[model samples]
Target: MSKQRDYVLRTIEERRVKFVRLWFTDVAGALKSVALSPAEVEAAFTEGIGFDGSAIEGLTRAYESDLIAIPDPSTFKLLPWRGETEPTASMFCDIHTPNGEPSVADPRNVLKRTLESAADMGFKFFTHPEIEFYLFKSKEFGPDGPIPVDRAGYFDNVPGGTAHDFRRESVNMLEELGISVEFSHHEAGPGQNEIDLRYADALTTADNIMMFRSVVKEVAIAQGVHATFMPKPLAGQPGSGMHTHLSLFEGDTNAFFDPSAKYQMSVTARRFVAGLLKHAPEITAVTNQYVNSYKRLWGGDEAPSFVSWGHNNRSALVRVPLYKPGKGNAARIEYRAMDTAVNPYLGFSVLLAAGLKGIREEYELPPEAEENIWELSQGERRVMGFDPLPQSLEHALAVMERSELVAETLGEQVFAYLLRDSRQEVEAYRRQVTQFELKTMLDTI
Candidate 1:
């Protein structure tokens, strides 16, 4: 057995753990778990546990119902929320078919496949996400709307406040699970919190994001409040975003850095940014998957609407933050369009695919948009060659359907399932008579 596997088995026995939870995600980024006693874990690591793939959202058909969940020992971590005695630990699983082939419909597999392509090109992808979400008083909301845990705004110190206490517990739990957190603060919206996870390899970062969400929710429930990662849970407040910082490395050296280049960004970095800008519209459906996600994108509180890149400009789709004098490895670009509710695995996959395409094709970097693109008129933006991203989920899906890059990166199974699931969401949304329509037009019209 590998060292990680052996260590997991030894640790479980030593800790007196009673249950081990095998975790995975569906196409929509929802967490799923299957628990087994400590005895089954060893067999699970080898023969794998059988499950109904068809029951999972977009996993497979009933005819191909047989699937296996193979535990990734490296991800094994004890559930701190479950307390120390008879503790329940968890590990993320990789789904495979009975024949032992990786399932193409698996979002995790989709990302791994894309990362392999990057590996073949001599690049290693990394990501750091500033995950944002809201804390509500309860799951049940009144007509006025959900109640936030506190009214504190950006960086407001609410000592003894629920938000403050919640963050402390959440961060501690995350650290216990081996997830490194860089920063945590109250966001601009009331009761909204932002926790930034430190950079890691793209796959590990995705797994951390999955765990982060679970930890947040678990902490909230334990404290008698509710937490949500919904992109837009309020009418006028700034929507939650996951502004992801991305970089590529080549054998321990930052490939994006060059002291002599413009903005100290290397040619490879420039092309990667070019690729992201070019493909932002097409990939929007995956990064910002929900219909509500469009509200966060177009709602415009530091959210980028147009396809442009600039140094220190939050209004552009891709922002190359000002470079620190001595921090060469920190040189990276932040893609601002994605919100917090994304399927991280698929989201990272498409983003990496787009960026890699740029490097491979040598896409010419565009001139920086010094002026805030959001402040410009449509005509001015058009003149500057800045095209806007898709204004809605439906529009994004249409763009994605035509793009060979997104289709190829997602593979046929995942691509088709995502399209079907997204189309259903759009159609369901279209049929609904929203509260706005009733409040505005019912009496007047």
Candidate 2:
């Protein structure tokens, strides 16, 4: 710990970093930061920086508002978007109460706690996310929604395209900050793009996700465009989803892999997938979390609506990608329901909890959907026990409210606050008349 702190201090001085940003996230996964002068960072590393926690949603109330942020030196990185002459650096912080206990309401801590539980079970959780978003002309919109910057479809390489240039710059900035991006390409949506980050431990992946979103937004603003992670930004186009690939490791071995098993999926992996299928509905509110998210889930441009898994079907909620001839470690389950708009920390926490529970309880893996679930009739799906995921934020919240796994995993304060805050959002949205409604029904009414 001392060596890491010394390294951070030395780097700050060597790089002449003008400001040090202490970063953390609110319970809802919004990034929060406090900038400190170089001289103050050393003391902050020891005593921590105090702030008003009540200002952040789901953190604290007025009566007990004080919180401290302790910088994790290992996360220290120079901000690539910030000027280089007098550079800015940032480090992720762990939120603590004044007495130095970890805050249950901290999203990062929530993930860390979940990771610890996984560690106790002799496993490590890893995630690789193919994050998708749209580059828009601007933030403003008319009767029609925001215009996409390009009309390029999936995998199209438009020469000198706006999205192309934007992705290059964003990937460059991310690499500068030491985030490993495995792949980037145009997605199915007109202006939507996807960047797949290489797999990392769950907690580090969550931190990288926060940084990834920031970098994308910063690059977009620099290029005089807007980037949105809104799950369903356009009505007719395919929606953006994170489409996370998840796996569990024991020691150095991929616990999900077995040479003799079907699809090379081991018992552990089967139970894990079963757990995810069983609890996916309950975790949807945390993973999707917005009214707009439901539009993507049920929108049906290959987005998953039913709770099923398969090796070849993209319509299934969970997908097992074809195993490579020599790559057993690459064996993983891709969870397709989660969108990029999620708070990765809370989302991963609930996901790990669900999977672990399945393993512990020896959950029975169900039959694969094998066929295109979207092409199936409602009766056929029901007959196969292919239960649909919660179709709306309202329905998702109701399902989540009854989830013991979610409640216990998120802890009391965060779980309660998320439910309360989300219900209020639902009610507020219910009262509003959307542009579609106004355009379609105003004259008819």
Candidate 3:
């Protein structure tokens, strides 16, 4: 066996891990897993474990259903929530065909393909995601609506509070599983919370994001509450967002930073930002995938609604956070349009692809909007050359349909599937009779 595979085997034996769960995500970012005893580990590493791909969403048609999942030994981690008596571990897997060809339908492989393009350009993509979510009183909702676990808002320290204890326990569990957290705090919305993961390479960060969600839900369930990553779970409340910070590195040096340039942003950084702004509308469907996601985008609760970049404007889609003194390595751009509900693999892939296109084609960065974009009128915004993001899921999908960049980034299989899926969603939503219509139109119209 290779040394890395040997190490995993030894670690499992030493830890007395009885079950090793092989985990992978579907195209929609749903977590799926299969458990294996230690006896299957060696063979799995070499030959891979076969599964019916047709059973998975967007994976395959029923006829060509056979697929293999090869566990990535590097991602092995002991599940902290499991008991010591019968310890369980987990590892992320990459899906492939029986013939050993990479599955284009696999979201993880799509990201790997995009990262390969970055590797060719002598740049490495790194990301730090500030993920926000809400905690509800119970899993089931009533006529009155699901209740928030606590009323605490934005960094409020609620002494002897459920949320505070939940955050502490959640952070501890994450660290125990080797996911490093940078910060955790209560968000602006009641019951809403945010956790920021430390920056890692794109692939590792995606894996960490998936784990982070699992851990949060696990902890919440144990505490007799429900945690949701839904982008906009409640009306008149701030919606959850991913608010990802991204940077490119050339070997050990930060490629986005230049001390003498305006705002300390290098030429490469400017073009990267330009690319994101230019393509933000086209890629909105993937970043903010759900119908409710558009509710958050247009709700104006610190969620960006326009395609603009600024140094300190939270209302703009892209923001370059001020660089701390002697912390040039921290220079990065934050894309605020994405939500907590997106599939990180595909989202990161499209994002990186857009920025790389900017760098390759030398797209020019637009003038910064230092003022609050939310305060500007439509005419004012138009005069300033600021464009609004898609107002709804249907509009966003229409923009995505014509996007050459998104289509190329996500291979033909995924691209076609997502389009069909999104169209179905819009059609279903159109047929639904909402509560608002019943409340107002029933009596008046």
Per-residue alpha-carbon lDDT of model 3 for 1-445, expressed as tens digits?
A: 7788898899889988899999999888999999999889999999999999999989887999999999999999999999698999999999999999999999999999999999999999999999999999997886756799988898999998989999999999999999999999999999999999999999999999999999999999899999999999888899999999999999999999999998899999999999999999999999998888999999878889999999977888999998898898999999999999999999999999999999999999999998899999999999998999999999999999999999999988898888898889899999999988998999998
- Residue 59 error, candidate 2, Å: 0.8
The alpha-carbon deviation from the true structure for residue 119 of candidate 3, after best TM-score superposition, in angstroms, is 0.6
1-445 per-residue lDDT for model 2 (tens digits): 5999999999999999999999998877789989999999999998999999999989988898999999999899999888887799999999999988999899999999999999999999999999999999999895677988999999999989999999999999999999999989999898899999999999899999999999999999999999999999999899999999999999999999999999999999999999999999999999999999999999989999999999957889999999879999998999999999999999999999999999999999999989999999999999999999999999999999999999999999999999999999899999998878988998999
- Local lDDT at 161 for model 2: 96
54 Cα displacement, candidate 2 (Å): 0.9
Q: CA lDDT, every prediction?
A: 0.94, 0.94, 0.94
Model 1's TM-score against the true structure = 0.99
Q: Write the per-residue lDDT of candidate 1 for residues 11-105, one digit (tens) a residue.
A: 99999999999999998889999999999999999999999999999899999998999999999999999997679999999999999999988
- What TM-score does candidate 3 get on C-alpha atoms? 0.99
Those runs of model 2 whose alpha carbons end farther than 4 Å from true positions after fitting are none
TM-score of each: 0.99, 0.99, 0.99
Residue clash pairs of candidate 3? none
